[model samples]
Target: MARDINTKKLKKNAFRYSKVRGETASRIRIPGGVINAKSMAKIAEVAETYGNGTIFVTNRQGVELPGIALEDMPAVNKAIQSIIDDSGVNQEERDKGYPASGTRNVVACPGSRLCPFGCYDTTEFARKMDKMIFPNNLHVKIAFTGCSNDCGKVRMDDFGIIGMTEPQYDPNRCVGCEQCIKYCNIRSVGALSLVNGKVVRDTDLCIGCGVCVAYCPTRAWTRSKEHYFRLVLLGRTGKKNPRLAEDFIKWADEQSIMDIVKNAYAYVEEYIDPNAYEGKEHIGYIVDRTGFDEFFKWIMKDVKLNDKAEVAHRIYWGGKHYDRSNNLK
Candidate 1:
């Protein structure tokens, strides 16, 4: 029997109202895109028991169990408690499901745990960030990629955190083979040149991608011990404008990046449109409305950046605006 449902409440509770009447999908949050095998089995159990025995993987590293009866939401919630607990997702109560579904699951690529080119532990950082800001209703997207290779496609999100590492060059170890130079030109920005039987890295031109370090034959170039990041901001996809995030800070420390993102929530609360659809609005749209200068002031409040961090005074983004004209120029 179909019953009157509060669709708004349903969505906030992390259940997706389906096209089919009296059916909903349970959205499960998977921070860092890494879940244990036991949790995965539990999700499968939930699907088989409550859903149509099918699981839909979401792009944001979440899972959705579709074809669940609307009335079975409570049972579904209780069944998924173990998965929620295992994932370390913050909750207001046990067996009540996700408290809020605004902030999307933190997405990450396999970093130092698996990939050779990875500069840092992307999954660890993603999980930490998720812990700081979850169980809230904020239309924000954040992603972490292992390195500039950007396997995570982070540039499409609101906060794209790309890994970086400053290369430490040792002239003593360099054999003048120029392998670093060759590969840097091919795989990354050509910031290295041979000088006096050794390689000279153009510090001004280097984006800290550490390509030279990876190709160094005799450990002539090595990554810095201090892990750094390239923080790109405000990229989004929508009907009006779909754009990639621009560089906000380079060579940024992890703590400063986390603090900056945390501050952004306050900025959004102060400036988000009251009439935004379902009280949800992308941070990029809010930035567009308030202007970058204002957004910067708000986002940078009390956030202390390290000395090596380079911040962009201003950012500009260009993308296809579907809301505009159809006439090709």
Candidate 2:
């Protein structure tokens, strides 16, 4: 007898329906892509016991345990409670597994904690962001990269938070080695030039990637004390249209970003298509339906940007619109 399953409930509980009959995969949330060894051991234990001993890693820095029986979901949930507790994921009920899976796992790169080019602590910020927005049923994706290198591939997400550092130049320490100038041109935007034996940066052209600061051999260029970010918006990968994110704000503060993301939830609630599949839709699509001005109005509600922040008045995205025409240009 085929077991009747409520697919909706199965997905809501973070369990993926498997192609094999009576089998499902359990999705585990690992915010910031960091997990303690103990939690990992627990996950392994569950996989060996309930699943077919396969742990598949996801692009969003999460893991999926496949080949578990549908009837064993309860046991699996009870077993993974320790992992959930260890990961500090926000849950509505104890031992019930994840409350919702619409909001995908918050992805992040190993920032200043491990990487030399990292501008900020990517793991810490990713965990904080997850705490703020997880257990949500909205179809939203957010990713954080340590620096402009974008090791986390943030641009593909709905909200891409890239770390930035204002390069602080000390003229007294400069020796005119021009290493900063050399690397800036090679690895980043050519924004640095030599004038009167001193490197001068083109403020307008600079993207705050900190290539100069990293390549400066004479300690002339240093990173700013205050952490900054570049917030990119509306990047998505779908059959209709796939595109990279565009810059929404530069030199944005952390609090302002958080507030903006929170406000976006409200915006989605107001404008999201009620008939959307399972009452969920990507924010980019909603923004497409409503004007960018309206989205800006909602996301910027009561959000105070930093003095150095630069916001785009309007945004136009370029991507392959499969919906319009499938013919290759």
Candidate 3:
């Protein structure tokens, strides 16, 4: 098969962001950022054999091989076959090469796999999402954070999946040590208090951060049966209008999250203008051009949120659209 090496389609083969003429950077997708010692050795070997001597660690928890000659990409691809296979980043097209890269890499915090305060398995979910969404050119970004700490910096991505945990309190088992209350007051949203010598939790103020569950020494605070996520959307960093994402789905389920993301690509295809911006159009800009209601209608088409899922009733975007007027100073 002819390698999809066109500058426009270079992403399909993980070659993008040109450097000097005749050279481009090849991004290696490390799904869920779980590169083991063996994988590291493999990457080092590829870099030494087919690329520049050094590899750049991407913020998205992936690797980038810079200074690769365009002509050498074929040999480079062959050299890193084992490394790519181990990462399973090519799940969509398992024939040996990447299918596409517009979805970019799926990022996740060191979740329950390593972090003490992590609520869920971020790496597992990240890889799963990657398998489903990648190998296509959708120009989308997604991130997963194990807890409210948001170590993965989810706010900058188009889709942010935050782990949520409903804390259950048992008054009888409470020793009134006030540990949960103290932790909540100082580290969390201050959703806990003491009344009548018993600890009380204000459910309305709770952000499902799981801080109380971890701080309770008496085991009075526990995780609720529901395993849910808070889905935020439309975040972007661009020259025209830069802004953080807004909350879209609260207490969302895994299936609904997937549906909304899959639908979003379809929405983009209908409204996108290939030549509108200098390059690919960020989804945020697309939403801005089309009214929110219209954009919402497309993504939510036939999508049924979970019974417990809460959808935002209204969406508003606020950002400065840079123009000559703003730069006229």
| Residue runs of model 3 more than 4 Å from their true location after superposition | 1-5, 91-96, 277-279, 319-321, 324-329
lDDT of 1 by residue, 1-329 (tens): 54989999999989997999889999999999999999999999999999999999999999999999999999999999999999999999999999999999999999878988888899999999999999779898999998999999999999999999999988988899999999989998899899889899888888888788887879989999999999999898988899999999999999999999999998998999989988889898888888999999988988899899899989999988888965787
Per residue, candidate 2 scores C-alpha lDDT tens digits across 1-329 of: 76888999999999997889889999999999999999999999999999999899998999999999999999999999999999989999999999999999999999889988888998899899999999899999999998889999999999999999999999999999999999999998899999999999999888888889888888899999999999999899998899999999999999999999999989998998999989878888898899999999999999999899999989999988998988776
Q: Which candidate leads the pack in lDDT?
A: 2
Better of 1 and 2 by lDDT: 2
lDDT of each: 0.92, 0.93, 0.81
Q: What lDDT does candidate 1 reach at residue 261?
A: 92
Per-model TM-score versus the true fold: 0.98, 0.98, 0.92
Over 1-329, each residue of candidate 3 has an lDDT whose tens digit, in order, gives 54345776565677865858778777788878787789789888877776778899999888988888887877777777777788877544443356677777899999989987777888998988888887777778899998777888897889999989888888889889998888988888898889998987787687889999898898888987877789988888878777778889888888888888888989888999878653468888888789888888988887888787788968786666674358655
Q: How close is candidate 1 to the true structure, as a TM-score?
A: 0.98
Worst window of 10 by summed lDDT in candidate 3: 90-99
Greater TM-score among 1 and 3 belongs to 1
Scored by Cα lDDT, where does model 1 land?
A: 0.92
